[model samples]
Target: MNLIKPHDRISLAEKIGRPSVALVVDDFYNRVQTHPTLAKPFSIVAHWQEHKQRITEFWWIALGGKPTASYSYDPVSKHFLAGFNQTLLSDWKALFFEVTHTHLSPELASAWQQRVEMIGENLLRQNDKLLGDRGRPST
Candidate 1:
C-alpha cells in the first residue's frame, strides 16, 4: 500500500520556503528550552542545533517537500523516551503554533498547523499505547 500523508502533496514547504521552516523549528525549540513546563521534558536533547536541523527537515517533509536528507525519524519512540505526556504535548503544540504564526503568514501557518494537529493526535495515541500514558490535552 502506498501510504500518502493526510495533507497530500500540497507542497507547503515550497510555499512556505526552507528558511521559514528552519525559523519555525529554531524558534519553537528555543522557546521550549526555557518553557516553564517543557524545560524538563526536552532536557533529553543534548544538542540544540542538531535537533533543530533534523526537525526542520521533518517539517519540510511533512509539508510535502522532497526530503533533503536520509535521517530517519521514530517519533513514537523518541516521545516515549522523552517522558511525553498529554500536558507536555499540549504545551508543545501551543508553542509550536506560536512560533509558526511568527514566521509564516496566516494562511500558510494555518495549513501547516492543521497537519501538525494530525501529528499531535497520532503522537498522543501512540505514546499512550506504548507508555500507557492515557490522557487528553488540557484543552
Candidate 2:
C-alpha cells in the first residue's frame, strides 16, 4: 500500500483562499522559529506578530496575484537588508520546500517551489550586487 495518500489540490486551494494573509505569515513565522539559524533573525523584530502578518501578505500577493492596497515595503529589499547570507537563504529555501512537501498537494507544491526559487534567485542576485561575492559565496 502507498503510505502517502494523494492530496486534494482543490481543497488546498480553498484552504489558502480563505481569510487574510495572516495565515501564511503565521506558518512562515512558525517555521522560522523552529529553525536554528532562522530563529535569531526572526527574533530581531520587536513586533513579531505584525511582521508575520506582513510576510504572509507578501506571499499572498505573490501567489494570489492580487493588488495589495496596504503595505508599501518591498519584501526582497527587506530580506536583503535583514543581513541574510547565502546559508541562511538556503536554510529558508529548505524549510520552505520541506513545509510545502508536508502540507501542500503535489500541484500546490510545484507552484510554491517555482515561486520560491524565483524569489530566492532574485534575492541572491540582489545580495551579490549589494554586498559583493564575499557576502554569500554561493554554495
Candidate 3:
C-alpha cells in the first residue's frame, strides 16, 4: 500500500477511532504470538494475556485522542530498553502491515501504514543516534 497523504491521515485516524484500534491491537498481538521472530520476545512477558489486553486498551486510548488522567509509558522504548532490537521491530512491522492489509479497508490500511512508517522512521532515527547503527540503514 502507498503512504497516506498528511491531510488524509487525520480522517483516517478518525475512521480508526477507538474500536478499530482495539481490533488492530488484538489482531496484531495474535499475529505476534504466532510469528516466529516475535513469539519468543512476547513469551518473555510474565502476563502475556493481560499485557495484550492492556496494549489493546492503550491503542484505543491513543487513537481515540482521549485525555489521560494516568501517565502511560511508551511501549516501544520500554521494550527496546529491555533489549528488543531492530530485528524484532522490523519483523513486528512486517506482521503489522500484513495484518492491517488483511483486516482493514484499503484506505484505512494506507493511513495506518503511513502512521506506522512515520513512527518507525522516528524510532530508528532515535535508536541510531543513541545506540549507533545496529542494523540495516534506515530507508
- Candidate with the greatest TM-score versus the true structure: 1
- Score residue 10 of candidate 3 by CA lDDT: 60
Model 1 segments more than 4 A misplaced: 1-10, 132-139
* Candidate that scores best on lDDT: 1
Model 1, 1-139: lDDT tens per residue? 9989966655888999999899888888889889999999888899999999899999899988999998999999988888877778778888888988888889998999999899999988887788554454353
Best-first order by TM-score: 1, 2, 3
Counting clashing residue pairs in each candidate, in order, gives 0, 0, 0
Off by over 4 Å in 3: 1-11, 61-64, 68-71, 132-139
- Return the lDDT, model 3, position 33: 77
After the best TM-score superposition of candidate 2, give how far the Cα of residue 38 lies from its true spot, in angstroms: 0.8
Could you tell me the lDDT of residue 14 within candidate 3? Answer: 65
Worst 10 residues of 1 by lDDT: 130-139
Error of 1 at 88 (Å): 1.0
The deviation in Å at residue 132 for candidate 1 is 4.1
Task: Compute the lDDT of residue 31 as modeled in candidate 3.
Answer: 76
